[model samples]
Every structure is written in structure tokens, then in C-alpha cells.
Target: MAIEWPTTQLEKQSDDPMVILNPKTWSHYHSYGGWGKFFDGLRERKLLATRCSNSDCGEKRLWLPPRCECPDCWHETQWVEAPQTGRIYTWSVVKYPGELFKLPAGTPLISVEIEGVCTKLMSFLKEGTPEIGMAVKAVFNVDNPTNSILDLAWVPA
Candidate 1:
């Protein structure tokens, strides 16, 4: 039987965690605030970052991914929408395709380390080599009908 990928288009406003199951593949959750709200903003073609909330310890989060905790300083964080552009810290060509159903076969997922930040975020390299310290940015796929993580991706800046 062919694998099935369930798609849902709901505006989830609840704080409760949402679960997503796939019989053909691994399952994932809708995720909580650290990523959910930020991702939702991406649907509108915007990016956001998390910052430490501790008054004594002010830390800036990097590469606005779904999960984050203060690495240097353990502190609560807030959200900040970033510019749609950044630089690549490092990347690698996917010569051996593996398990992610969301990505196309043999596609390159570039790991970008945005400028002015100490962290690197992974994104699909639409064009060019897996160079370090190269410019890159988040490219949202709005045409996609599925409300999934694959909807948001990265490309050269």
C-alpha cells in the first residue's frame, strides 16, 4: 500500500500540546510557544527569534528553530522577529538520502550559521555549495497546502 500523509489546516490557539501521527513514518507534535507561534508567523513570510527573559542574564537566541533553552545562561526567553536574511555558518550536500519524508530525494539541506549569532540553523540549500559563513535566509513555501514543517524552508540570501 502507498504511504499516506495526513494534512490538517486548523488555526490551533490552545496551549495544549498537539500530536501528529504517521503510520508510514515517524510522528511529531505541533510544538509549543518556542516554535509554534514563530512558525505560524512564517506562514505570513516573517521570521522570529527567542531571547532570554532573565533580567540579570540577557542572552540572544539564534537560528529561530522550534526548540531552545539558554545554553550559556539558563533563563526564560521572549520572541523577536528577525530580518529575512542571514549568513551560513556551515552546510553539507545530502549524497545519501535518508528518512525525512518532507524533503525531496538527494536534496541538499544547508546548515546556516546566521551572522551576528553564535548558533547555526539547518535549511535546504536551493542553490550553491555547502560553504561556511555564506549568506542564507528562510524561504517559506506558501503554495503548499499542508500545514506541516516542510512548508517552511531555506534558500540562498
Candidate 2:
């Protein structure tokens, strides 16, 4: 099913027959260094991260699933394989009905805090209460013919 972000107010239906909808093309920022390499890893059913260049900084960024930019220091990023799991720092259950169908019914979207890192990454919670500080693991799906970063779901570790 097609997904639609709901409009706040009712509107008259369009009568123009020639009206066309332009689908948004998914894109990655190539100008951001090392982003594609991380995407390639996701396509291969793996998770990757970026580590800060300065040893003293020692900050690690996790998720696919992410671009090369440091949300914190905005420094040049170096690639590394992330541990397959972490813990949920915060989460909210998406109980309200919506236009999106790819998401399962009553699903909870989770934001995880990577162990030993001072950052959080978002993913779908698979099972159990998404309490803060609960252990979680990154799981991959490679058997599917079509997959993206969404194919990497998270469950309790």
C-alpha cells in the first residue's frame, strides 16, 4: 500500500486529468565521504560505524546506516564495523493508525544507545518492552531479494 503523510485539513479533490505525481528518489550524499561504503555494507547485511580521527576524541558513531558526518564534532569520519547490538536509550510505541503500511500494526520505533558511545540510532523494535537501557541486538535479513537499511531490524540483546 502507498503511504501518505496526512494533511491537517480537508481539501477539494483535484479535477485535472493531466496531473502527475513525482516520486521522491532515494539518494545518498556522495560528497559526504564514506557514506556509500556503509550503504554497501547494509546491502551485504552488515552494520558499520565511523570513529573520530583524533585518538583523544574516541567518539564512535553507529548505525547503517549513517552518513560520514559526525552529528557531534562534524569532523572527518573513519569507517569501522559496529558491534551487532546495543541498548535502547529511548523509544515510543506508534499506536495511532497512519497511512504507512510497510510498518507492522502497533509497531514501536526504537532509538538505541550504542554501548560505549555517546550517540543514539533509530530502528524498529522487534519484541519486548522498549524500556530505557534494555539490551538490544542488531539483526540482519539477507534472504530477502530486496532490502535496505530497513531490513536491519533490532531486538532485545
Candidate 3:
């Protein structure tokens, strides 16, 4: 069997029949800086964070929603993998779902404290009622990662 390849050089064309795209696409973007590593971790199903990079900062552990600088010493931070397991720090039911995270009405949004991280990460509960300090684990939307933090949820561990 023979395979065929395009021979003609392609050029930018406003009316190319083969090229279709959203006519008025809308998108949101952010300059994530040090937190940029978080998305890379998402693609690999890992939870990453950052810790104080300056020795003078004296912060020996990682922090979630990774800070660009240390809160204590104001030093730059380094990326680290936070434990995917945690317990609910708190939760609230959203009556109206946001367009980005289209959860059912009354779906619980949880703040989880992953092991080894000093910050509480906000995510939706996969199911079941949430209780204070309820054990949970990070669940990645592997099939449909929206490239947003909303792609991560929590379920009973």
C-alpha cells in the first residue's frame, strides 16, 4: 500500500475550505508564573505546589495554590509535588453553577487540605455530603481536563 502526503505548500488563507475554526472564539488566559507548573502536573495526574526557595525563608515544606514568594520571608518558591490525598477543611453548596464548572445545583464545593501542603485547595466534591475534616482524595478529570483547576475534584478516600 502507498501513502500520500501533501505536496503543495500551505499558505495563510482566510477562506480555506479545509481549515475550520470558531469564527468568534472566546478564551480566558492568565499569566500563571511559578504556578504554571500546576497544569503540567495535571496532565500527568500529579498534584504540584511550591515551597520557599530562599534558604533564609526557612520554609521546609510545600504550599498549595503555590505562592510566587514566601509569606514569611518574601523569598521565591520552588515547585514540589503535593500529596493527592487529604481531608475536607470546609465546604459549601453552590446554588447556581458557574459556566466554567458546570456542577449540578447544590453540588458541594470543598476546601481540601492535602497532606504536606500548607494551604487549602478549593474543589468540588464528586458526590456525597461533606463533613468537616472528612477524608478525601484528589480525583483528576483524566478524560476531560479543562486545563483549569476546576478539572480537579475530591472524593471520599
Clash pairs detected, candidate 2? 136-157
Error of 3 at 95 (Å): 1.5
Ranking by lDDT: 3, 2, 1
Kindly report which residue pairs in candidate 1 clash with one another: 53-76, 88-134, 89-113
For each candidate in the order shown, give its overall lDDT on alpha carbons. 0.64, 0.68, 0.80
RMSD of every candidate to native, in Å, equals 12.7, 9.6, 9.3
Better of 1 and 3 by TM-score: 3
Put down candidate 1 lDDT per residue, 59-150, tens digits, no spaces: 55554563355665766567666666777666666766766556666677666666554556666776655566777777887665355556
Decide which is better by lDDT, 1 or 2.
2
Q: Assess candidate 3 and give its lDDT.
A: 0.80
Alpha-carbon shift of residue 105 in model 3 (angstroms): 1.8
TM-score leader: 3
Clashing pairs in 3: none
Highest lDDT scorer: 3
Quality of model 2 by C-alpha lDDT: 0.68
Residues 43-126 of candidate 2 have per-residue lDDT tens digits of 676677777664555554453455476656777667777777788878888777577447776787888777655457788887
